[model samples]
Target: MMASFSGVLMGNSTAPRHWPAWTIYLRTMGLFCLLWYAMSWLTPNKILLPSPLDVASALRDRIDDGELVANATVSLTRLLVSVSIASLIAIPLGLAMGTSRLLEDLLEWPVELLRPIAGIAWIPLALFMFGIGNGLPIFIMIYTAFFPLLLGTAAGVRNVDRRLISAARTMGIPKGTLMRHVIFPAALPSIMTSARLAVAASWTAVVAAELVGAPSGLGYAIEYYRSMLDTPSVMAFIIVIGTLGFLCDAALRSLSAALMPWANAEEKR
Candidate 1:
């Protein structure tokens, strides 16, 4: 087993072929493990701070029990589903509102009024309106992601170059074709950026929602650890959440880069 593990590590060429990235990753993992060990060994109190070893043990136990995987899967699923729904509506509505002065004026005040309200604050109202189970957290995630995406989309559409639009018209392009090809593509970078932000926000909102009464999720795990006074578990959960968020953001960024390579020029300019 030990030999196989070593071989696996050595074979991973995809992991930092260079010394710097490899060294940094190794050091980071080592530091985290060391701190965890020291906490477990030196910490006299379990309630205030469980040692790193204890948290690892708990994590292992939970994994064995199949709780961690289940929770994580549930939370991820809720996030994806809710964000999809929100994106479907938000992108189109935002485009319409952004491109049309009359629609923008009509929706602007209502969106502004609602935008000020925090996701957590809406828990009570959501619970009352949508009820519990998965609905509350799903709604919260959608709610958090929706506004940023909508605003970004609208702003992008509004900021489309008039010259390009005029040129498209001169070429006898239909309004729909112009919007589909010229306007949306032009504003894609901004829309993508907002979508990234919205995804991050959605994760935060989902965590908050899970905290309310979620049966299984990272948020539930944190709450469970807190209630049980397991500090290590709490810290572990925090690390997991942060790591997941970072990964999600990185993935979004990668996707944006892939879709809009020209956006890179905008950055250089």
Candidate 2:
């Protein structure tokens, strides 16, 4: 009889524990849905400020027309290519700067001066340099993402523990091996954070570049809708942009967290 009572009590306790998480999730979702509905219904004009439903309908139409996917793919491809180029250039430059004090001193002033300038500020120059093709926006995106990555990698390399370097040297590790195995691992989390920031910056730059002159992209779609006063379509594009940015951020964060589990543990500590 006592065993039966203990088992029943444990089962009841476990059941309540599972219920709380589900209950909280449901309540939060319900609140968001209610707010969304209220905002859509209460807004005055569909053209001026369309409801969520209107945006949904517009998005559906765009998707059905196959324009959204194609444009999105172009934008995404451009973003990826630009970021890849930036990473390749930035990482080597950062390493050189971190390893060589003289080089860092030489570049510091120029970087400090240039980094303050907005990425969009480069658009006119890029347009002039690359003309009105894919290169203009790609250049802007690369510029937007590059500085942060370089600075972050440099900082990370500089911050690597002296003790770790010493230990590697004591173990008869070659200088290259020490850098590859010790410094790189120690600096990786910081570099990952920088990369995440670069991705966001690149995403923003790409849209701005598209707005300036691209014939097709999410940015162009928004510009087109704005010109037409089609609030639903504009809102849809905004949602899509936000969604993509959020997804990129989330994915990078997940990857960073996985690569640097010590970061999470350190946070708790």
Candidate 3:
């Protein structure tokens, strides 16, 4: 089992080499579409689960009308802004906490206490604090994205080799320079993984926030169509969400590969 796991991680020949990753992904999605179609056919109520064709038609209409594109733009903007702000704050704070025992000791308990709380759980409080506007959704997205990034950065820093740090200090390298040259690179893989996770979390939180308060966005569109019993439209929006999430993750992976080529090579191996 361990050998198989290690082989998978190392991209070794544990399985048939003929099936590439993209081929497998395509096959899986094809199977999913087939299943969806079959389910839609078998169901008596089309309103509950719209057929793929119905969803496609609705999606095309929304695109032509600019509704989906406009709302998706709003949601994407909010997601990007929130995640950027959270990353800005969390990365430095996490690095500081990981490097400083005093700081970690002081903040550890409070962070632990808050980490378990779901971002959606704060919807009521956010609504009360920020009222009905972009602020509510942005706040939720930030709350969702923050901790994963913070924890990932801290873990990355803590995992850095003690010998490297000592050697840098011996060479008279300044603390900031040591962290930048040695620590940040060493911890980048974890940080990137956390960033991908943060994007997913932020997307989910933004949707939920829109459902509750926002007048515009993909979530609001979904809710609007759902209330009107427009299952096809709702399904279309859901497909949009999944596609956007996949795109966001892919973009992050590309950025990670570009910034940390060595890490990317190691991962491929």
Candidate 4:
């Protein structure tokens, strides 16, 4: 059964062959659209689950009115800014924590205490602290993304080949130079994986963060038309949110592939 699914997805070969990315995407999307249309036809409540054509029409209206562009731009910009800030702070702190036992011990209690708290749980307090605006969403997203980045960096650094570190130190390499050349490179793949996770986490959080706190964003727009029983537009915003998240992850994946060719080569092993 798995092979059959793989054959359809990957290629004609039951042995499971490689398929072009576009081919896989089209096949999956086509299947999804078919199922959706079938369900919508049978459901009798088009308002709740409209056909693909209806959703597409709603999407086109958004594009034509400039609402889609404006809201998507705001959400994506906030995503970038929040992830950047998270990486800048979390990655550095992660590196330090990974390297120093004492530092980790000192911060372990607080980090653990805060780490388990969901970002959405912070929304109520954030609303009170930052009010209904950019601050709330940005703060929520930052909190959402920070832990993954920090933990990934720390774990990546800790997992570095100790032999390599010893070899460098034995060669009389300075601490700064050794870290720049060896530790960072060795940890690059883990760090990149963490970055992808952080982006995803941030993206997920942004919707909820925007849904209640933000004045304008995809989430805000979804909630806006939803209040008026605008199901198609709500779904339209949902589709936009999904599509943008895919693009953002794709961009990050491309960046990881481009910047870390060695990681790719290693994975082929």
If both were scored by TM-score, which would come out higher, candidate 1 or candidate 4? 4
Each candidate structure's TM-score, on Cα atoms with residue i matched to residue i, is: 0.84, 0.85, 0.91, 0.91
Which residue pairs overlap in candidate 2's backbone?
none
The lDDT of model 2 is 0.87
Candidate 4 lDDT tens digits, 1-269:
98677678876654645788999999999999999999999988777888899889999999999999999999999999999999999998998888899998998899899999999999999999999999999999999999999999999999999999999999999988988899988888889999999999899999999999999999999999889888889999998888888898899899999989988898899
Which of the numbered candidates is closest to the native, going by highest lDDT?
Answer: 3
List ranges where model 2 is wrong by over 4 Å.
1-43, 262-269
1-269 per-residue lDDT for model 1 (tens digits): 77666766898654445578888899999998888677667767677777676667777777788877788889889988988999999999998988899999999899999998888898988878877688889988888999999999999998999999999999999989998999999989888999888899999999988987577799988998799877767877777788888988999899988898888767889
Error of 2 at 121 (Å): 1.1
**Candidate 2, 76-106: lDDT as tens digits:** 9998999999999998788778878999999
Comparing 1 with 2 on TM-score, the higher-scoring candidate is 2
Of the candidates numbered 2 and 4, which has the greater TM-score value?
Answer: 4
* Number of backbone clashes in candidate 3: 0
lDDT of each: 0.86, 0.87, 0.93, 0.92
The deviation in Å at residue 60 for candidate 1 is: 2.3
Error of 2 at 98 (Å): 1.9
